[model samples]
Target: MQRFRLADLAPAPWRNGGGVTREIARGALDGATDWDWRLSVARIAHDGPFSTFSGVDRVATLVDGAVRLESATQTQAWTTPGEAHGFAGETAFTARLDGGGARFFNVMVRRGRLVATVVAHRTSGVLAPAQDVQHGLLVLHGRFAVETPAGTERLEAEDGLLWAGARPALRATLDTPTGCLVEVRLSAPAQTDGAA
Candidate 1:
């Protein structure tokens, strides 16, 4: 298990070099967010044009402030941290801020290769049954404790924990009102022997 603090997150320019993103963790240590196995965390601060990523499945959640996102088919309004939006990273879209600016939490994986979900739970609750894939939890708000078969540890916003190999037992409880959670479940790759 690893812990990340938003206050400690480092921001960098987006892959497209348009805005900025905070890469929390990736691959083995976390999860890879590339053609093979892509997974990453980022935040957006400005409202401008939409950036496109090829062949990547992505989920973006509103952490702070309000953001309006538009796609070819429809437009989405993410007003609170609990609200999450899923899309094809390759799709064209733009982010329009309602005010000064907004902060977002994002996760991405290879398209068609894996499935992911983003959800917000109350201060005290347990995740429903999750099978077939690995689980990753990213705390979006407040300080909380994650109790798994391994043990219990405190997690602040931006902190993450991974339960891989097989489905593991887990639960979370927040100590504050600003608490939110983002859950990710990714499929494992099939093994194949080299050509004979």
Candidate 2:
């Protein structure tokens, strides 16, 4: 269990200079950039084509401001905070701000290798992750108390935790009336090759 402040992540300029991205966490078979799955936040600073990821699928959730994204086959406008959109990483879409600028939380999973789900949860009790499961929880609103093997700690909005292997019994409790969080749950799918 690792703690992070979303607003404090260091941003790296995009190769095309159209945006900046802050990687929250990633998992790779070889522990390198060739990620099996990745979680990140990106600032769409200008109008440019969304980069393509050959064997990946993506989910982008609007965090702040608004933007309109278009591709040859589809156009998506993110006008509301928390609105989420899913697409093939090879869609070749372009994005332009609908307002001032925009920020989004993104999840990308390598095709046929893993499965992922992103959802918003109004939390109040234990946020327990199975020992073999991977989870990312970003506090969208309110405060929380995270209990882990290390100790209990407090977290507020824009704070999060990325968790994976060698897990411990953990608990996360909402500190306010109602707290909302974006939950990214990743898991491996059962093999279908019939070689098991």
Candidate 3:
């Protein structure tokens, strides 16, 4: 098991010229591969247009202030905390700020082929052992500690964990505050741009 710190992550521009996204963790831990699923932690600093992804499934959850989301057909405003929505990656979407800019956590996975889920965990507990799916966890917005055969590592807001290849038993304890949980399930090998 490997742990990533939020403060250590560097924010970069979003792919395909969309808004900026801070890539916290990704499968294989390398920036080259076109991963089957990607876990990105980002802050929507402004309200404007968004980019379009043709073959991806996306999930967005608000972790901070109120914000509004608009697509080609509908416009919805998310004000409450932990409010999340999913959309097709091919569609064009834009974000409109309500009053002030808000922070949000986003997860994008390849549609039909790859599967992913995002959960905001606020209670104090431990995660049970499970197998069968490739998993990755990102600590967003709280202090959470994970224990494994390697050792104990504490994750603060914006930190992430990337796990691939095989399943290994792990345990976690939340003694600090609220945090977000993310896991990904992939079916095929990662696609490369040259092959496509």
| Residue 32 in candidate 3, Cα distance off native in Å | 11
Clashing pairs in 1: 27-31, 27-32, 32-37, 32-38, 32-39, 33-38, 33-39, 34-38
lDDT of 3 at 100: 75
C-alpha-based local distance difference test score of model 2: 0.80
Candidates ranked by TM-score = 2, 1, 3
Off by over 4 Å in 3: 14-18, 27-33, 177-196
9-114, model 3: which lDDT tens digit per residue?
7788755443557675555323536765666666676777766678888877776777777887987777865667777877777888877767666777766656
- Candidate with best lDDT: 2
Q: Give per-candidate clash totals.
A: 8, 0, 0
Cα lDDT tens digits for candidate 2, 78-111: 8765678888888888897875778889999998
| Candidate 2: segments with Cα more than 4 A from true spot | 30-33, 131-133, 148-150, 166-172, 176-179, 193-196
TM for every model, in the order presented, reads 0.80, 0.83, 0.76
| CA lDDT, candidate 1, residue 165 | 49
User: Each candidate's lDDT (Cα)?
Assistant: 0.70, 0.80, 0.65
Name model 1 segments beyond 4 Å from true: 15-18, 28-37, 188-196
